[model samples]
Target chain A: MCGIVGLFLKKDDLRPQLGDMLTDMLITMTDRGPDSAGIAIYGPETEGMVKITVQSDSPETAFAHLDAALCAAIDAPVTIKVIDTHAVLTVPEASEAAAIAWLEETGLRIMGSGASMEIYKEVGLPKDVAARFGLREMGGSHGIGHTRMATESAVTTMGAHPFSTADDQCLVHNGSLSNHNQMRRTLARKGVFTRSENDTEVGAAYISSRIAEGATLGEALEGTIKDLDGFFTFVTGTRNGFGVVRDPIACKPAVMAETEDYVAFASEYRAFADLPGIEAARVWEPEPATVYFWER
Target chain B: MTTTLDMTATDLRAVNTTLQAAARAQANEDYEIINPRGAHAMACGLDGPLTVTIKGSTGYYCAGMNKEATVTVEGSAGPGVAENMMSGIVTIEGDASQYAGATGHGGLLNIKGNASSRCGISMKGIDIVVHGNIGHMSAFMAQKGNLVVLGDAGDALGDSLYEARLFVRGSVKSLGADCIEKEMRPEHLEILAKLLEQAGADAKPEEFKRYGSARKLYNFNIDHADEY
Candidate 1:
């Protein structure tokens, strides 16, 4: 079991409160799944620049001289911002692939790579995880958070959610996949490698592979109902949009609220009670097997 | 005595504790619960004839296992509202999510708006009345009681039903196995009339068609194997 929370702001004024609102939303679901938690935030982006968020067990050594090493290897200017155990690196857009490759060879794990998105996750109570990363002060256009209770995999940071393998794409899941091992092998054969043994990571890779092959977000999500077998409610975020889908059975609980200012998705209605102007929001459950997406 | 509890500050446990104390003392008190904010398991295990009115929406399993209180939700309800209730009156002013009144043994559950799928599954003597439409598979495997749907009934109504009387004023998409349209005798019409009056519904009893178990597969008969 897990808790998934997502917010896509339609109004720019609410961006400053994105982290604060998301933090409140995630913590409300602490009773749902309290093992581990993670979040992915999509913030402002610069022209022709990409950001790569990475996590290290020992940040003092893993991050030291990392910017200089990457800048020298890729022959491009790279800047890094360290927040606790995670670091966000900004580099020339063209060198993103090369920089990622260079970092991987140096035995560093890349959490996420996108034009504006940065992912931070760890194994702990959601409240502690959020406090460790100072998540309440960060702001973004759209964000997704997950609190996980391990079912198929061991409880570890690598098993936590917001698994992103492609640029500008990440997904958090609330249910288990019945056929993930088969699909994982299928994705691996197509050259999409998921770094963790978590089933949710395989789900994320499947969507990324589909989008990489030029399928629209809706089409890719629809494909999940046919190709993947499981009870799942997936909330995915891209550079410009947020998407939600439930399996045909829709066994997991998911509620969505949309207003003039923003669209929110949560595993339960309590997560939405604290949002600003929520009493007037159009609250309802998304239909089973249907893809609901919103873009800025 | 009548009291008011503000859930936004007092939390759910305090409200429950106060109600439990009132019930233990047999004080037929009236309570006003404000700002429930979609919390689960509110007003559960009520065993006294008290009046508890919730001012806002509630999350899952609200009013579950109620014994004798009269509970009312001023707003919508999440899944399993009034589930496993042995006795009482639970009313919803707005729509209800899935499994409303599920596995109830004895109670009167009334929903002013639509109810989602599995409205009264496995019911055992509860009287459920939905003013609006109900989703698929309602009254599945019900052992006994009455289900009155004033609006339309979705697919597979009363599947595997056993002795439960279902009255639908609107169309039924399909009937479940062992469930079939039955003759609405005067006794059934009288039951429906009483149910409508108890629920404060406006629909006429004559507009509804009664449904129940066919009893064709109630016992093991090789001749009915094909039907099974």
Candidate 2:
């Protein structure tokens, strides 16, 4: 099991200082997920072709080689960088789907891609990852963080989440995708490149691609909800705002506490027990198959 | 003296106020409570040397989160009694609902009657005594607790049990995953006797049988998960 926390509010909304509160929420849930942590802040640049992650052990060299290939293949400049263990790339003019297919043809797996979000993750305790990326200081109107305990995938930075693309779509998840391999095949036929072995990233890419192609985040999530099998509390943040929903069967635990100040969700009540104003607040479980969303 | 708190005073704050008044009335002395009508979470979130008694049935989470307090319910209780409790005594004079004694870090729970499903789930370091039968899935996922049932137990007893010892006197409906019936020793009988005596159950320990985990699911082995 993993723990996920996200705060959503309208732009320039008046809310109290919650830096320490958010950290405390994450810290309280360390027992649920002890592997890795990552968070992404969505801001101004919300356009352009998405950079898809391709997993090659030689991330730096693989990204460099793939950059040259994309440049030669699409006749457009490709921007690349070796961020920690994973490499991120942005193609100036080519469609993200086309770039993903081109990269897959070269046998490199696409890790993640989006134009609206920047994602950073690594393997370790939450504090270790927080210290690495300085998560304490990162702030946004809405942001999501994940502490993963690598069940189906290796305990690596790649498995850590709030998987983002060059576009503005980012997602963090708690629970498994039992039918991920089958869904990955379906996405592959549509030229969606998936890099990480973690099924969460695959689900993120699928939903984000749908939203990028004119589907609302809620609609894309609704489409994926029927397609996605097994227990999951899927939470996604788009440029419009942030939305959280759960799968049909209520197999995993997800509790919610929302106020005009902000909305937050976690795998347990104890995680959100210390949130500001949660005392005397209404706390309830996210019912199975229900779409209770908060957007501003 | 015993007093009556009617059903309308069922809210937590109301119950807290009454309990405080009761505490003051019985200051520096032993006390008892009677005729609390359908109040959920009665005497919950309290810590004291005070002894509380509830005479009738209850709703969810009765006597939850007690500390150093001795609570006695003469009738049936709802779910989650003594949940996450630390250092106390909660004796149910009748049957109890699911999740009884859940996550109890310390204390003793004496159920003079039967216990419903999921009893002692996730229990930690508490001593539980059940004089009568217990329902299905009792003690499921229990950790570091001692559950003693002088009578029978229902299906799936001690499912996913972790370091918790269960002693049942009669037939088990079925053993749960990773749980096994063990040979009862003289030392275990002594322990059961002491627990029964504490609960005023006065049952014979020789009639009881012990159950516990087989220790297979401790480390999260992928291959062995199918067995779970």
- Candidate with maximal TM-score: 1
lDDT of 1 by residue, A94-138 (tens): 998999999889887789999989999998999999999989999
DockQ of each: 0.58, 0.04
Model 1: share of native contacts present?
Answer: 0.39
For model 1, what is the C-alpha lDDT against the true structure? 0.91
Q: Fraction of true contacts kept, per model?
A: 0.39, 0.00
Task: List runs of model 1 lying over 4 Å from the truth.
Answer: B152-155, B169-175, B183-186, B206-209, B221-228
Among incorrect, acceptable, medium and high, the docking class of model 2 is incorrect
RMSD of each: 2.3, 13.3
Kindly list the per-residue Cα lDDT of model 2 for residues B59-96, writing each as its tens digit.
Answer: 46777877777788876666688888887798887667
Per-residue error at A102 for model 2, in Å? 9.9
